[model samples]
Target: MPGKTKRSGDLATALAALAGLSYLPPVAAAPLTFASPPAEIAKAVLDDEPGTVAVGIWRNQQGRFALQRNPVGSVGEVVEDDSAHAQPLFEIGSISKVFTGLLLAQAVERGDLSLDDTLGKLLEAKATLKPETAAITLRQLVTHSACLPREPQDFPGYGTPNPFSRHDRWKIYAGLSGMTLEHAPPCGAAYSNLGMGLVGQLLSDHYAKPWDVLVRENITGPLGMRDTMQYLGRQASRLATGYQHEALQGPWDFDALSGAGALRSTAPDLLLLARALMAGRAGPLGPAAERALTPLGYFRGDEIGYAILIRGPAGHRTYHHDGLTGGYRTLLAFAPDTQEAVAILASNSHASPVKVLTGITASRYPIAPATQMAPAPAALAEYGGVYQADKDTSFTFVAQDGKLYRRSTGTGFRALSPGGPDTFVDADAGARYVFSREAGEIVRVDYYLGDSGFGGFSSFSGVAGLRTKEAAPPVAVVSLDTQLDYAGHYRARRIIRTDLDLDVRAENGQLGVRAGNWFRRPVFPVAGKPDRFAYENGRSQLQFERDAAGHVAGVVLYENGVIRLRRLP
Candidate 1:
């Protein structure tokens, strides 16, 4: 809310009317030249990020170029209103988990699959996946460390609006052979989009083909790519169509989570798959997909790590990955000792391609900023203990004034903001945190939630509803006959007792609910003190527990997982 400052005579009468139209200086367009980009830092890194509209930036390994678009942002029905000859086409979510990690490193270099093969020898008849996830392998499902079960349990019956209907991939692997287990395998590095959509359903059930025609016959027609594939309405004619600072869409077709957030392409076919996975040289991943991009671990702590299909900065270690559905946002990177690589892709789902590829890899490769040292006061009390990432989660931080704040880690002390000098910044802005010092001492930190998914309740944690700023719960007014009997619909049932339904309604005087389309709404009661509630999408709160004949009997549901529903009948 801090924007009202202009009163030095209204900023000297708006700088004397912009100093008389600044002698007509509006010409722009020629300053960017890293092979042509500066169309205003490419429209502030893709239409100033409010549900962007086309932005492609690839560098090196031959696919060198910068693509642009923004006229009014929309990718499908062409509302890039001539943002300089728009040519959208995106989706590329999960950067299609690097073509399902190069189709499982080309079936482990054609010895036909065996990254320690298991999943109890790849099933598909009386089907099964959980027997402690059949001793997970296939290199722990392309390095997500195969702890399996990131999804399935009929993911809310997959919000079916043709959610890639092939009878919804046999009800999403018959609901992933009935779910269980949330941690184990390599346990630490959790990013799984159902572990790369089960390595694109185990490379389309071992190439009996149909994971988008085996990734268009083993990786987009042998990297000729031509507007890539994995249907967006059969490549909605050079697709793109997607945006979200409220609406305007097109291009979202995940057909069986198309091996983890489907692919569509065009950043010149992801710079020919990031110059053949940063040139370990020659395509479908050799040198074992460059040893499956070496990086697993750090699932949390500072927030980023998983190796295969790379991420942020790598080989000084950063390797990255990012993608989102419902409007596309993609990012891919490589740094294996700086042969350097990057990919951005954006149509817009809050386009923040990891701060546009970490400010374009620090403005086209600059690095060299790590020289701060000297601040260790007795290893700041072993960086103030308590780290705990899973075991009902934990987080603490507190080395006060000598830096390191994060206190109330169970959702309160967000503090950690810096980005180097031992990195920081989480509560998901695609999470981050890296420390590991030693001779100067902090030892180990690592938590990088980037390459998405650890997701749930995020306005990127600005500690929604100001959590412990104390005193807020006390608003609930109700009574106009309990707001007209809590406004209507009401169906209830599914809070995991399963058969689905749920609904619950009550408009104008608010209330809402939904369940499958995952809705929520209600928040009202702004000034008085009655029973407390919130959720106009984020800052999700809701009190209403009653039972001394006060009527309501159910609802505790605090933000990410506290649920409690009841009140049936």
Candidate 2:
């Protein structure tokens, strides 16, 4: 951590000392001479970070905004004079989920909608829905417990820009017909983009206006958030250039899914939102904002209220959310108890502005480049444990060689780089972990990451979330002939999308399933379920559907629910 008075050499020494007695090599041949950072996280220090970073700070009812654009490893004493310029717009990504959630709350407050209102009642005139789908409530969609899949599988692919653009009112209405209630409604509070998008659709229809129009009429217009909008139109020039790694990326647009992550805005504009949220009953959307911030249930490692994640105890809680699209990244956080808020918008996809946010609030900035020497072996052991999230989410962290490693099913531990004291960074997952200590002993570890859903920073006190056994051994494979028996073209019977079909074949006698338009993916048989196969590392499953004659008639694909496909004759 660099204080306004701390020298560069002191920072290196401090970084080295974080790993106990281990020595660390210098990150650069010669320390870059730079002017002293501000005593507070003013514009000077914010400029020190790489890429384009726009930040908004609200404290004691005053709002301050700052923006900085510097290449990696280029920041030194001389700060770029960009502070006087206008704050550019940014694609705020999943932070839009929060706004969508707030929209639902606003409707609830106005008596136009009820959290308990069934999907059937809301869409009875607009679209036909399966019995199970119709029973889903407005609250489940807002809280991401609607049992909807994470996203629509009928897209070009995850790599394509504007992946959700294909989704519209028709598909949303039609998709409900395929719903199969394998699990009860409000299924375990997992993150679901589809669920929130549906909320946006229902709200839009209920108001007899487009989704964006509804948002403006109910929330943004009342709060005077002019720049926060669904469409850029003539404001395109004000939108900053977004980047993913070294390549410049294009902006994203959506149709019906716009409610999930379609809005774009400035840091200053976002701070206005935080202000309204912190004001609670005193704000314009007081009742809705208050209800939006209510802690309803657990998601990941913390309590969730609408689309925001709440941490800390009682009145001191901090409500936060992260938004990530291909080219932009964003974080919006506010504390009602202290009336403090921070909104960060980064132009580069790779920038971690949470460092800036946490740095300003906690006064603890992370070590840059982020690699560090291993702590003593004895010190590393304290971090080993298992952790769980959202009921179905879980992982294990193993301490080794001064680095803690983690994996979904608890084996195959990939190394995590240390960021700061008791903090670990998982770059792949885009998350940061911090451990807490009591009486010189590790007590709890907390972390948060961006996703399609609103799981807040998860805290595992001691090993409570992670105290678990090892993963089970690999399941035995069935005979090769048995695998070959299932090889054939399986066309979706009722699902209306190109991404609906699957081709199963035996390559070198091992069964592989090519789903939709993508290349073939290998399948693993589930343990104790001989007829079923799992793929995409078990995020999806396939169970061959058969008739009374014992002939394979089709296949049922299981993601969040079952979608049936018929075998081509």
Candidate 3:
């Protein structure tokens, strides 16, 4: 029952407090003026596309404009957002990692923790860690090239609706410690949520304090970021309501992984921090700020490069991070060279403030095309239908009330609109997903996030591989007899050997199976396919093998590899 609901009670408390509170009246004064912003910049901000909410520009500590604008709407929609008074205290997610990095840099400055220290050395001799991961260094974690897998093989508490709960954090870490490494650390760059969370743990150990408290004392408290909180708690009133598409959605609180993406702050507070970072002599980070943003390595993209905690794009190098929770999207960007920063927070999960924010740095902000023509309903309808790349991988495009929606097998579809016959716009970010057809049939799907291109997918013609299929209806629907025989922990011995477990139960006409340490998803049987059943962690796949007697015997779990389990009591 607890797992079924995603909304946090803490978030609700925060909202209740915010309900009666009101901001001071706006100054009847003109907009804060220091210098003339580019005319094109103003137009891009004003002509905000659909799915966008708040847009602000701060240049050289002089010109600042806080404009409330809605995507694809009249001035009233913009006015409703109240950009002038829209307190931007939303969870900025991984952007909080940058703050954690600053704390680490400060620690190194004080001779408390060194960047060169390996993870094994940081932990007390009593704390257990896998032998392979002992070589993982703090430096590798910062650069995101630790080659650490993104999550523990058996981690289940991840992606919960109310991810900030105490139940999620302790359960997830306990599960992770029991797991094995997918690759050795420092082998190559692998973006990992687990690796970042471990950094928080290490920092906590080094300071002999809690991770959240350490962050507050070293960074947030010093920067005067009163609104940022790792847990939603009773402070939700100042937080903006998060939305999925257009409807209000539940909140996300990363309690255990606070170092990875747990802090929430307003735009003004973020800009204040950015201004300090640019000044290079602010609070706890004074004189040691340069070490935090130095280039570590290339990012996972083509256009820009990554340096440890810093991301360099084109002419400017910035300390940046963006967050993507279910119904909320947040962005924070600051030019390390110019001391100019822009924070865009959108309540709508479909909203994309990144394009508008990044354009300021690139000098090519997106403007609505002057010539606009609505596509014919019939024309848009033709793009609808399922498209397959392989038997194992397929995408579907369904036409809903004249608008097109796209989805993959295990993922949900978001509404998309037309830009051209071959191109369609992502309703959220205004990015393009282009299609190329062969003999009037789509063959390739290419995605572009602004000017940066995301590679395309092509159909793999007639390759021999296991194809997913729905099993036919069972001839005999009988309850499973082996209940007590199958109850207990089963370790994944081959691939990860993550000491994961499975619990079995017989109820009402069928067998129910629950697996994983933290997050438990229901495992349903494959109809008429003997012991085979569908198991979905993040992605779903068929599992279980039958013995010669047609009884469930060796269990083969497929997730990047085949993990077998011999039944144990």
lDDT string, candidate 1, 1-569, tens digits:
00122212221211211111111111122222123342333454454333434443343433343455554534222121212233557776666776777677667767887778776677647357777777777677666667764445444322222233342556766665776676557664445566667768777877777788887876677767767777656557666566543345455566555787667776556656666666664545556556456554333322232234333333344355666555566666655454555556767554544444444333333333334543464544455554444432334454544555442221223334455555554322234445565587554554443421222111221111111222222232344466544333323355466533334454323344544323233344334435555553336665556688777656555667656665566
**Model 1 quality (TM-score):** 0.27
lDDT per residue for candidate 2 within 506-530, as digits (tens), equals 6433467755433344576677775
Tell me which of candidates 1 and 2 scores higher on TM-score.
Answer: 2
TM-score for each predicted model, relative to the true structure: 0.27, 0.62, 0.54
Ranking by lDDT: 2, 3, 1
Task: Give the alpha carbon lDDT tens digit for every residue of 383-446 in model 3.
Answer: 6555553322344555545556654433334456666656665423323456777688655565
All models: lDDT? 0.49, 0.63, 0.51
Q: What's model 1's lDDT at 294? A: 53
Whole-model lDDT, model 3: 0.51
Residue runs of model 3 more than 4 Å from their true location after superposition: 1-52, 63-76, 79-88, 157-159, 164-173, 232-234, 281-284, 302-315, 357-361, 364-569
Select the stronger candidate by lDDT from 2 and 3: 2
The weakest ten consecutive residues by lDDT in model 3 span 19-28
Clashing pairs in 2: 34-77, 35-77, 301-458, 386-466, 387-466, 443-462
**Which candidate, 1 or 3, would have the higher TM-score against the true structure?**
3
Q: Which stretches of candidate 1 lie over 4 Å from their true place?
A: 1-93, 97-132, 135-186, 190-194, 197-228, 231-262, 266-343, 346-569
